[model samples]
Target: TALAENHPNLLASRHQLAGAYLADEKAIVILKKVVEMYETLPEDHPGRLALQHVLACVNLRDGEPERAVAILEVVVRNAEALPEDRLNRLVSQDELARAYLNAGQVKKAVAMLEDVVRIRKAQPEDDMNRLSSQHYLACAYLAENVVEMMAKVVQKGPRRLVS
Candidate 1:
């Protein structure tokens, strides 16, 4: 709370506190406040996008896949509009794929993951993004047949795979 007061303008600080709260039972309350703060920002503001992404994650964590899919759809659209090389764009796409899977949209998730895989593969061979994207793509494929295959599932990460 002190950080929130001391750095009222620092969205990241508030986001950190919100994330901490989101890890526990108070997630609903904390996420609501953070989402509200983010919604007040301009559409193009990075903080708004980031907050929307966080809300999407919270929605998923709360077992509300439909809500997550809804939020991720907007995030994915905005991310796709950015340059192809932008890390946030790729990360958003990946997250959207995860949301789709969580929402039981397997084919849709596969399509998005395939797109990410293709894009990453087009980058330099040494790029970690290429490697990790390939891995996630594979995992997504496995996820589609998980019921039959009986395999463990892997979730997407929020961090950029490449530097």
Candidate 2:
């Protein structure tokens, strides 16, 4: 904690600590402080965006889907400059879709997850990210009463399931 306070520019320690406490409510406090420290950074700065993403996850864990959605919306927008295959952008989109789902915006979640699923499809079928997007897309479809779409996603399951 002292080190983090002393070297405000050094986010690695603070980030790790925040991650360690993510399951605890303390994570929100820690992450908020770290995010504030990075306020001087540009909105699209990778470090700042990454911190925001973690903060959003903490919000999600605390059942504050609206907050998560707000943070992730910005993260996604800023991440547009990154490559399409960048893990951070893909993961941010996935989390944002989840935020929409939890906030009862089922249609928005379905639409967002559809894009994520489409992008992940180009990756290896068994890739964790691809599978996760597919799973969430299924959930979104289920929530939106699109049972046929859900069934189609299920049919395109990972190789192990297909076998």
Candidate 3:
């Protein structure tokens, strides 16, 4: 606490602490505080955007998907200035899709995840990010009741899974 107070801008430490607290019910409070500190940074600053992403994840975990969507929307928009293949931009897009899913916007999630999956497909098939995006795309399809899409994803098999 003293360290946080003395070095409020020490985002790396704050982010680490927030991660450690995520399993606790009070995680939202701690993450909110960290996000507040990050507000002092520029809107597009990587640290600020990364903290916002974490906050959005916490919101999703707490069943506050609307809040997660709101936060992730901003993060995704800001991240657009980054290169298409940038890790942060890709991650922001993926999380935004997840937020959409949790918010019950299955169609939107499906569309976004499809795009993410397409991008990830350009990476090595063994890439974890590609596999993760494909998995999420399948989940979105399942949520949308697109059984054919889900089946295709499943048929891709584990070895073909991207990110």
The estimated TM-scores of all candidates read 0.74, 0.83, 0.81
By the lDDT metric, which is better: model 2 or model 3? 2
lDDT of each: 0.76, 0.88, 0.86
Better of 2 and 3 by TM-score: 2
C-alpha RMSD by candidate, in order: 10.7, 8.9, 9.0
Output the worst ten-in-a-row residue range by lDDT, candidate 3: 1-10
Per TM-score, the best of the predicted structures is 2
- Worst window of 10 by summed lDDT in candidate 2: 1-10
lDDT of 2 by residue, 53-139 (tens): 999988998899999999999999999898887889999999999999999899889998998898888999999999999999989
Candidate 1 residue lDDT tens string, 46-91:
7778888888888888889899899888887777778886888888
Residue 105 local lDDT, model 3: 93
Whole-model lDDT, model 3: 0.86
Cα error, residue 2 of model 3, in Å, equals: 7.0
Q: Which residue runs does candidate 1 get wrong by more than 4 Å?
A: 1-11, 123-128, 145-163
